[model samples]
Target: MPLVTTTEMFKKAYDGGYAVGAFNVNNMEIVQGITEAAGELNAPVILQVSKGARAYANHTYLVKMVEAAVIENPNIPIALHLDHGDSFEVCKSCIDGGFTSVMIDASSKPFEENIALTKKVVEYAHDHGVVVEAELGTLAGVEDEVVVEAGQESYTHPEEVEEFVSRTGCDSLAIAIGTSHGAYKFTPAQCTRNEDGVLVPPPLRFDVLEECIKRLPGFPIVLHGSSSVPQEFVKLVNTYGGAMPDAIGIPEEQLREAAKLAVCKINIDSDIRLAITASIRKHFAEHPDHFDPRQYLKPARQAVKDMVAHKIVNVLGCDGKA
Candidate 1:
């Protein structure tokens, strides 16, 4: 099947109380891993490209890869999206370059400026038969080119959501409700020790989410930085000569609960990166002579496939939901 807009996917997710996974793709293996898993599970998926991804992989290459995924996974629904688009120009480029969805992230701007910028992108995107996603609040942590330092992040003001969506006419909204952008989402100080002495991050601000749902009613909501960094991968990376200490992420149970609400789209990036990194590190540690990219990348791709499959069945609850 051809690429689809998120309109139908979000509608079904909203009514079904599940969210589609939006996995960021930068290259062939990542695209193959995510789409292959989504196809196997019959889950609708979004393959999103970030600004850094476009710079690294080139827009044409990324689009062609997603198109190949569409061919390979014809049974499931898929969408090409631009994640965290910083301006109207980027959004317009994606829309024109075959993306069925684009996000205009102007949450860092003042309220009025955000609305104005988002609205402009929304208008152009709609005209091109594409959907627009907009952000309301700043999320902390680093993801490619997007960054917000600790203490600078802000939660979405529930009061402003109604106005922002109404004026911008964005198809979906990404809200910051304690979920952050990277693997090290929280510092050691922000978490408490569990029985295993693992630093457990704080709970998501579902109260804020509930208020936004009450105001927006049936509108589709999105959660960015929603990856639940699997500790096993973190341990594997650290075990194989990596030095990522105390890297934490949103709890899967919390993300599951959010998916059961109005949140119809959940963004996951860091988890994919960690999975690949851990696999490659472990492979090299075990086999010191393998130098070919495929020798390592094959296992790294399987790691992504396994991680995405786990997310489809466990966290997303969208298995057989194509």
Candidate 2:
């Protein structure tokens, strides 16, 4: 299948009561990992490129990688998306460059400014047959260039959601409930103590999530910062001589529950990143003489594939969703 807009996917997710995984991709391996997993499970996927990603890997490379995935996985639907485009210039560039969807993230601005900016992007995007996702609340996460400090995390205001969507004319809304960006999502102190003294993070504010759903009704909702910090991956990182203490992420059960509601798209990136890092660390620790990047990258790629497949089957509930 050629690249498609999220319109059909989101509608199906809303009607089916499941969420599609919108996995962020930066490089060839990352794109391959996500699409391979989605293909095996007969799942539709959204591959998104962040502004930082465009800076790291040139925009042309990112677009071609997504194009390659479409050719490689002809059976599953793939939506090439621009994640967290900060300005109209960025959003317009992606839309004209053939992205299937774009996110105009102006949530940090004042309400009126945000609406105006998002509306501008929506107008241009719709003209080009692309769907747009607008944000009403700020998510507390650090996905590359998007850095939200600790105290800045704010939930989406239920009161303003309708107005934001109506004014911006967005196809979906990205809201902040509790999930944060990156692997180190919570401090040990912020989480609850488990039986073994390991910290289990607090459950997401489902009440707030429900309120957003109520405001939007059946409209598609998106959850950013939704990675599940797999403990096994963390342990592997530590065991292989890497030191990342108490790296945590949103719990899978909560994500599963959200997928059953108005959440039609779930964004994930950290888990696959952790998998690649852990595999590389383990491989290096086990083989000190290995200098070939491919030797370690191969296992890392497999790790990414495994992680994404797990997210599709367990958290996002996108398996066989295509």
For this target, which candidate reaches the highest lDDT against the unseen true structure?
A: 1
Decoy 2 TM-score against native: 0.98
Q: For candidate 1, lDDT tens digit of each residue in 163-254?
A: 99999999999999999998999999999998999899999999999999999999999999998999999999999999999999999999
TM-score of each: 0.99, 0.98
Residues 1-322 of candidate 2 have per-residue lDDT tens digits of 7899999999999999899999889888899988999999999999999998899999999999899989999999999999999999999999999899999999899999999999999999999999999987787768888899877888888899999999889999998888889998877778988799887987888888899888888899999999988999999999988898888889899999999999999998888789988999999999899999989888888999989998899888889989
Residue pairs in clash, model 1: none
Residue 202 lDDT (model 2): 77
